[model samples]
Target: MKTQTAFPANNLMGVSQPDLKGNGQGGIFNKAVKLFTVAEKENGSLIDQLSGMRASLDKLQMNVFIADKDLNLIYMNEIAYSTLKAIEPEIQKAFGLRVDDLLGGSIHRFHKDPQAVEVILRNPSSLPHQAELEFGNVVLRSSINGIFDTQGQPLGYVVNG
Candidate 1:
């Protein structure tokens, strides 16, 4: 004879109740939907904030390049673009890409040891880092700083050279 249990087998197995079908009502599904909605809204807000910040950075006279957490080049201000453009020949020789191609490219492409650079960029404590980068005959002194969100979570890096 089987003994009666106080709770349902599904509950013991950690399965969601049938009532919580994530149908935008009270349930695990609903909670997951709400979580995703909040996350999307936060991401939208971040994008908007970044857009405004990018506008401000665009007007700066300094050569600035912004990369995402994964080190993908996202923005290169006019000064940065022009500065890189001036050395397009060298850049092409080294990376086989034009300045226009730099956006959406990986910052690692410019480094001799990308894995080492990635280690530093991913560590907040290691920044703001300063280094001199050589491209053929040209040597550029660059300052790398991590960008953080309101919660102090790293957003990316800004390279000012």
Candidate 2:
């Protein structure tokens, strides 16, 4: 049996193009469109803020790394990149990952128990935490903190080592 919907499917295109003036579906559709428009504007603003932050972070003397909410590595300051590069060989032997693949990669690769780590990362209260990580013969101390937006939404995390 065929099903009915507030926005009927266009048989030829197989897409629902709800009427903006007719059914109650128009109200819901209009609200969703407005919501998306606002979100786009907010995202653009966030991008601008991050670009400025990146410039400042690049000038720091210490190693600094950033990861998105999904735990994907997003940014590494100059010092962080160079320091990691110097130990790339050891890292390869220890984790079987290349330093060049660090950016845009999952932070899980560095953890022995990623799910456990993820639990902490996702919980803002658990952050501003400190830990020592061992890679090969090197022991690095890291300070992890959550990054949040103006509205207190989690953007990701920052790690200083």
Candidate 3:
């Protein structure tokens, strides 16, 4: 008579639990995935809300731009891009101005005091900071605020003008 081994055979009570540690197959590790799944799902819809908000801001003749902590452009609403492009056609044309096309780009050139803008990005605060930015000959009144994550860590910045 032969005795069947459960541990070595990778079976328990006729159920097979994958050895995540050794075999690198299905296991607790698979279940440990993406704790923020629900939060992420909700966060994923933020783009829609942001778009709607941007549309509303446009209607109010406002321009909005979002940048990462490194001051890389991430989002520039239709109005922001078009308005800037119209005011600074040469700059816009110099760099192909669109969403992803504008990604990692900087709006520092548009700022009247680019260094002041840098100071704000380096500081992590929710309180909005105001700056005067130049678009060719036009001066835009810009308000910027740092975007924070769930843990209140600075994620990026939002600019509205």
Please give the CA lDDT of all the candidate structures: 0.60, 0.63, 0.49
Candidate with the greatest TM-score versus the true structure: 2
**Model 1 ranges off by over 4 Å:** 1-48, 150-152
Model 3 spans with C-alpha error above 4 angstroms: 1-61, 90-101, 109-116
Worst 10 residues of 3 by lDDT: 5-14
In candidate 1, position 54 carries an lDDT of: 61
Per-residue alpha-carbon lDDT of candidate 1 for residues 59-154, written as tens digits (9 for 90 to 100): 544566677767888877665776677678877987798888778878878888998987887777897787776656666666777766545566
* Number of backbone-clashing residue pairs for each candidate, in the order shown: 1, 0, 0
Sorting all predicted structures by lDDT, with the top scorer first, yields 2, 1, 3
For candidate 2, list the clashing residue pairs, or say none. Answer: none
Summed over model 3, clashes come to: 0
**What is candidate 2's lDDT per residue for 31-114, written digit by digit as tens?**
333333344347653234455556656765556677776888888877677777767887899899888898888998889999
TM-score of each: 0.67, 0.68, 0.51
For candidate 3, give the lDDT. Answer: 0.49
